[model samples]
Target: MLNRRQLLQNGLLCGGAAALSQFPTGMAFADEATRLYWFGSPARAERTLAVVKLFETANPGIKINSEVGGNDYWSKLTTMIAGGNAPDIYQLAPSRFADYARRNATLPLDEFLGKIIRTDKLMPNALKLGSVDGKIAGIPLAINAFALLYDTAIFEQTGLKPPVETTTWDDFAKLCVELTKAIGKPNLWAVGNCARYSYALEAFLVQRGKRLYLDNGQIGFDIEDAKAWYGYWDSLSKAGGCVSAEIQALDKNQIDSNPMSKRNAAMTIAFSNQLVGYQQLAKNKIALTSLPILEGSGQSGLFYKASLHMAVANNVKNPELAAKFLDFFINDLEAGKALGVERGVPLNLAVRDVVAPTVDEVSKRSIDYISSIADRVGDFPPQVPIGASELEERVYRPIADKLGFGLLSVAEAAQELISQANRILKL
Candidate 1:
């Protein structure tokens, strides 16, 4: 009986031999095909499809059958893996990298890194993000840092100073209040309820020298930290700094639905790469700024994370072709120009340098913002544990919604959240 890794290797060699035999160089085989899967907005799908078309034109022998845009992407991927039909190449999030890599669902690309996939120009942190146990399971296509995106027009009109790198969370809340009062609009708000987001919560924890999960896969922060986090958001919500619960409930929690994007709020906490898409949706001029920090914290807790990784399945029939596509996607100047920052800043520094000048002002700012944070941001935290996503979607967001609606007090919400996280993380 072969183990999973051995089986994977066997599949690769046998599949490659069979594929190559059927479709020798000069002519394309009618049945040669591979699948690519990903989930994102229409803009992301458009940009990705554009690049896929380029890849196809360049590699006519290989055909890519693509699928995009589904709310149940992870669930569908899990089903595909179980059925031995995972996409040959897919977009993998850092949060789920450990889960797929540990299960041997993803291909290890160590053999191809320098030989097939170019990495000399790739950012070191971006490389680290796709690795687990020293094996490269994915190639980070782009990088993103946490940021506060605000409408510059709103700030200018209100005569308010936008958030700076040094601005504390306390100061951020006050600014929200000031902005809300100055605007004096019933429907419009200063900011969204950021506490309802896992990234925002993680940022808060990291600023205080705690992490969402420790290296050992246990819950990192204690009850006190949880209380402080929820309490802060609850206070902000009540103080009219954040959108009301009704308005927040209507939000679908994506780039298009975000308060700032909808023009219902002046600010939002979002990934640095999202500025481009957000700017397209928002009427006001969208600009990126540093996330509010914990006062006198040990570190800024801001770190560059792979927005998403391009991963090849371990059981892919055409591993070599997938590797080639990965190389082109990461290093090709034309692909980079087409992608812009919709997928976050390019992880390949050489590509970024060339692409930055050619992109829109919003995208250029995003690239510059990422560059400006090199010295201040901390190291990327550990690969989010197996149950981390569940904790965010199942435990964290629901509890945050309850707190926002005043169904649960801050103490109650914190206690419930911590207890659920501990149980889920097996701490």
Candidate 2:
């Protein structure tokens, strides 16, 4: 198996050569067709291929190749980058973007922005997610915001109204209780898993006028915010309305397949991109809506986050052509429509509008719902801290699990989380 460093160097050299050869003869070597290697899931492979085919048709000189895998994508990507054989461009997540940015392995797009593509057309906040240290390190391909997915049939059966319009978190809790009491134990949970601790915590912090990380990459929120947030989940779990500790402990896919989709849970939080998956598994129509806001919270503090997908690589034979390919994938309406939302919600405003009419009904509803609430959504939290991504799984999971199980008091769990987070963040 190739090590990470070696894979990266090799990929970089290939991409660099491809970039150079795109220039006029005598300006740069023109021998090799620009190579763009993509790392993606098998589910997205067909869509990726369609998009690449469009790109190739538009720019006939460049050659593109894609490699598809599921579950092991991160491991493979790391190995490829470390081996210096990285793709000309590859997918990246917001949670992990800081690591690549800090290491200088990815190209910064600021130097070539308008020259290659019009950066001005992207939503400002969406554009900002791909940037680090005031440099645009990658181009966002799609945006995804957290939303509530509720079973409309279940709500009608129980005579319970889904929280459609904005409501307070306190009201949210009451609804969970009402739903749970009406449905009975194990058969129906008011809420799904609370095991997505980091995402949950960030949502709380943003709603409360705080953030997980400062723009400069330092820990941003205080212990009080963490305490209030943990307490929120603990209270709900204690009420037996949300998924219990036993259920939250399962891996995400397991939870999604079992309780959430089985209609054991009346509602759950999910990304906008998950509409297709939920539709396939859910027996009832899944209603999409914005996450409940805290009472009296101002709209200025809320904003939906763009999907974490961006392209960056350490090696490329043709940096310019690679950049152009990235730009076209995001900005070209026809190309984006062909790929659809396989990557997430398209980050390009023009592409989103172009494809909006053609998406599935469920997907269109999700997009429309989020767009209606876009003004209320806050900025995306700063790129997750170094080691923060791992810490999310290691530190936050136990606390959430403990609270869900009723084994740890909210106060105790809050205290423990703050101490651990501070130690990890060096705050």
Residue range 1-427, candidate 1, lDDT tens digits: 1223432454321222122111122333244566677777656665766677777777766666666636777887787778777778888887788878888899999999898898888887578888877798898889999988988998888898999888898999999988999999888889998777888888889888889888788888988998999999899988999898877777766887887777778999989988887888877788887888878444677899889988899988778888988898999888998888888899888889889899888888999999999998898878878787788778887898899998999999989998898898884
TM-score of each: 0.89, 0.87
Top candidate, metric TM-score: 1
The regions of model 1 sitting more than 4 angstroms off are 1-33, 296-298
Query: After TM-score superposition, what is the CA distance of residue 310 in candidate 1 from its true location, in Å?
Result: 1.5
Each candidate's root-mean-square deviation in Å? 7.7, 6.3
lDDT of each: 0.81, 0.68
lDDT of 2 by residue, 147-219 (tens): 7778888889889889855667789888898889987666568887554457656766777778877766666
Candidate 1 global CA lDDT score: 0.81
